[model samples]
Target chain A: MLQPLRDRVLVRPSEEEKQTSGGIVLPDTARKRPQEGEVLAVGAGRVLDTGLRVPPAVKVGDTVVYSKYAAMQVSSEGEDLLLLEEDAILAVRD
Target chain B: MLQPLRDRVLVRPSEEEKQTSGGIVLPDTARKRPQEGEVLAVGAGRVLDTGLRVPPAVKVGDTVVYSKYAAMQVSSEGEDLLLLEEDAILAVRD
Candidate 1:
């Protein structure tokens, strides 16, 4: 039940997919860092100078791709969570 | 004159200050990563489900603080630039 403020999003980072899209296996150190997560919650949105609130693009349960190292890691009740700005989300998985 | 797309912004990262606000000097390795930058340009904002463009929260020439590694660094014309989404900007300096 942890909610973020403003345009921040709460995400549960998925386990890294060790294989590449082309099915190439890499060594532990050579593996690319995971950049995908599942949206758990979203904030009300960012406030603009014009007094308007910008709506978020992603919703709960959506699978999203984010930039590497662009999020904050927080632990709550033994659960691993990621807090990031909405803009960190680069794309939505179909 | 590189313009970012969507909600991205172009920023010029300032040189890292070796001294703290209280005049404490730290070694290079112990120094905190610089998180501040000056906005150089902004995109046309992010699109929403309603097909409306959300106004940006920060404008050109504003000093902003972003996450340690939330932005993409691109070098243009011998100038180091950072491309970050508006949401990655955590706060504006007074």
Candidate 2:
């Protein structure tokens, strides 16, 4: 099991690519990197000045879409891993 | 100036794609989204239990590389924008 530190989060990218509403296959050259993924692990919430832990809104297994250029990539166990902070995440995909 | 909230960071992506060491043009389909960007703004640091504000390491104009699938995108002023937390950032490029 992977555990993030501080407000960091670990995410696994979805293997599929996003298609435009028109069904045009946005080539990898045209489409930005896939910015959607599944949450694998999350860090403990950050402690506020008031000594309260503000839990993150995201959890493991949650599907999310983030900025293509907003996370750090790490190689673990021969797999690509992403580490992000909670605020780096935008919204959860339903 | 844009200001992120609660460890959030604002980044402007570099419009260039990453080429493999062999110079293979990883098509948009073959390559991931360009996860490299320049830091535009950062949020105030999270308050630690020790009552210290741990400032973020990223600052405006600093070039960075992040995870493509780890940030949220927002449309601001007709430009595509990305919002991410500091932890989502990987390494700063010189």
Candidate 2's DockQ is 0.06
* Over 4 Å off, model 2: A1-94, B17-34
lDDT of 2 by residue, A3-91 (tens): 79878889876675223313443444222433667898899977777787867767899887554445677767776777887766655
Deviation in Å, model 2, residue A67 alpha carbon = 13
Model 1 misplaced stretches (Cα beyond 4 Å): A1-94, B17-34
lDDT of 1 by residue, B11-89 (tens): 8866762123235334321212335678899999888766778767678998765553556768889877879877666
Docking class of 2: incorrect
**Top candidate by TM-score:** 1
- RMSD versus native structure for model 1: 11.3
Clashes in model 1: which pairs? Answer: none
**Cα deviation of B49 in candidate 2 (Å)?**
3.2
TM-score of 1: 0.46
